[model samples]
Target: MIDVIGPWNRMHHQDTLEAMFRLRHQVFVEEMGWDLPLARNGRETDQFDTARTIYLVYRDEDGAVAGSMRLIPSVLPHVLGDVFPELCSGPVPRGPAIFESSRSCISRKARRKDPNGMIWGALTCGMIEYAMLRELDFITAVMDRRMVDMARVADWHLNPLGPERRIAGGGVVAVTMPIDTHALDTVRLQRGVPDPVLSLRFAGARAA
Candidate 1:
């Protein structure tokens, strides 16, 4: 079985955090050919990997990082608002309720065997589950246009913030998705998860 958990306290979960970085390096730098700078130690990280970043990590039975995504508070310096302001027409959505999700990575090995798309669905559902636990309204993300169809199939309420634009990986769109029961159920069903994917444990908190 897969183990999914997060909004992990980075300070308290340093080992797991390191594993996540390594997985990101493998996915984004080695596989995707992204030009982003890697840490001298060979991990993919940036200014965004700060205290405020909340993460939802998917782990295999042995507890190795399989897939993961990072969530940043909209009010803080995030990719959608701070890095790609031109992508949105008006003010970027910012508040305690809305969060910006980015830096998603699913290991190549996992993808090779994820014929049912369960890993992707699980990560997506975990994000919504995290929002529910925190009483948040929704999540904003700069995502590849391909996800638009997945959102449709999964019954997610994705409201596009603006038109699609070409980015590093290809065409991408900004979207705001609600974190409500319908959305949650849709994601869970899509992932084949009968219940929650996120297992919460409090250590401390920070913002990205």
Candidate 2:
């Protein structure tokens, strides 16, 4: 299950957090080789992973973390403030209309078939789940380039903020997802986008 984690649940999910960080290092550092100039320890983290960050994790039967993601509410603190102000001519978002989701990573080792797809679904679910819990409307983010490109043609509603560019070490772009808190977790017959969305539903949870 992909569990929504706040500071209240961090202690129970320490192992999951470790695995999440490890996977993040793998993808954002070793695999992508992003020399994050903003990193404190030369890691991929920006100013986003602070106390205001919301963590989402999916675990396996083997008790290892499978998927992970982090979110920053635009109404509160967010990356558009400290990181990429150039996304807009004036200033980045800090409104109730948007929530920034980031720090997404899936474990390298597979716990099931198509680990990447599983991670995407879990992360997407986590965003929807958070929106419902917090009574928000939109869950957006400055996404990686590939996701932005793929999302452009998806059934999911989107608003593009930036083109793909190499800013963070290699290059990544920014995009937004207009998440409906009422969005169903179950997969729909979607057409468009090369990477398909995850077929997922929260256990014991129904669509709002």
- Give TM-scores for every candidate, taking all chains together and pairing residue i with residue i: 0.90, 0.74
lDDT string for model 1 (1-208, tens) is 3233334445577888888899988888888888896454669999887766788888876678899989888878899998887778778899988889899889988888887878888888888777776777889988888888678766786888888999875999888988898998888777786576766634333221
What is the number of backbone collisions in each predicted candidate, taken in the order shown? 2, 1
Q: What does candidate 2's lDDT look like per residue over 1-208, in tens digits?
A: 5676565546676666666777777777876776766644434566667655667776666867776778776866676656676764445656764678877776566535563365566567656656655666666666666665555544455666655566655456556566553243331223111222222234322221
Clashing pairs in 1: 52-207, 52-208
> Local distance difference test, per candidate?
0.79, 0.60
Name the candidate that leads on lDDT.
Answer: 1
Q: How many backbone clashes does candidate 2 have?
A: 1
Candidate 2 residue pairs in clash (backbone atoms < 3 Å): 166-171
